[model samples]
Target: MKKDYNFGYTKVNSKQKTKLVQNVFSSVAPSYDIMNDLMSLGMHRLWKKRFVEIMDIKENDIILDVGSGSGDIAREILKENLLTNLYLLDLNKEMLFEGKNRLKKEKNIKYFIGNAEKLNFKNNFFDKYTISFCLRNVTEYLLSIKEAYRVLKPGGKYCCLEFSTPKSSLISSTYKIYKSKILPFLGEVIAKDKNAYKYLSESIDLFPSQEELRKNLLDCGFTNVETINLFNGIVAIHTGYKL
Candidate 1:
């Protein structure tokens, strides 16, 4: 007997998929941030900045930054002095360590190794839940959303920044060329993991569109769900309130 897992647009057996994803990240973790800038031409920074700007962060906010690779999102939030407790959770221990090392001086931060589909947190505990550039990579992304809702306090905000399909024909066509041709090339050259970067590029088109994702959030017990597309839908910031 075997169970299937999604690795980008393709499905594989559960163990196989998990191993592949782990290997991919472990191979790229050291060069991950660099490749991001090269691959996206630095647009990812703007997308992240916009996502953080929209978060309704208040004083003493307890935030769970799920899939917080290298702690960039967590650091951005902490820089604003908006959080009293900031938890950085990632499935991969290597990524968690990278975050811990980067944010070593931060006293209010904690790192945890946890799965998104099954987060180890108390219900109604988090004031904000942020998952950036990571939702689609989860084997059970929908379940992850439900788990996010479970942990968020009433009126808590759930926000995500994820790659999405472009709505415009011109931008979409241009993007296709870049991801298919340039992304993997840059990956091989920079990260020495061509396949890993290939998988990342492939996952973008496999992601749910903005409206469909909004509906998923609504179905998962979220309210006031909305999305703001960036760069004509190359990415989007989806947010909802748990009420």
Candidate 2:
């Protein structure tokens, strides 16, 4: 029996979901950054900045950034600590190519086309692991979380920045309207791919909440689990340590 997972609002088996997600990213790869600005009104940039700040990157720390779309978070981390060794991994080759193109000038940065649930790196290799706005789309998010735990060295930290449930009723209602109605419209006009953006909106709603994610981190042996809500919990940064 094949286990089912979400491909947007539609349910499919794990392999289909992975292929569907890859197609979605491939279709939107060219316009991803543009649509991000349009979708979040440039708030994603600030969110990533704050996400990196919370990481408190140190000089020469080895970092693995999973689902490292377009290298936005990688760029932010490098800006803070240029000496940090960075690995950017993504399932979609097009997305990885975009990231590689953007960070072409940076040193100590390597990009790989890979899956988050099954990272290629050896156990306890990375000092810090990060996945931004990417886990929701994974075929098995729990497996990805476990992989994050597996790859981080003892005493290393894991940070995940993602769209999460909102704290306020009014904002939540408005955000829902924007996501369901406005986002796909912008995707069509800007990215010329409405379905891809539709998946983005649907995926966010289906993703685990901050507390739920904190519990997952705890379950995976991540201690000192903490969540920092940004924009009133519309987006959140979850951090934990492998002790």
lDDT of 2 by residue, 159-192 (tens): 9999999999999999999999999999999999
The local lDDT score (0 to 100) that residue 150 gets in candidate 1 is: 98
Candidate 1 regions exceeding 4 Å error are 1-3
Off by over 4 Å in 2: none
**What TM-score would candidate 1 get against the native?**
0.96
Clashes of 1: 0
Considering every candidate listed, which one attains the maximal TM-score? 2
Model 2 vs truth, CA RMSD:
0.8
Overall lDDT per candidate, in order of appearance: 0.88, 0.93
Best by lDDT: 2
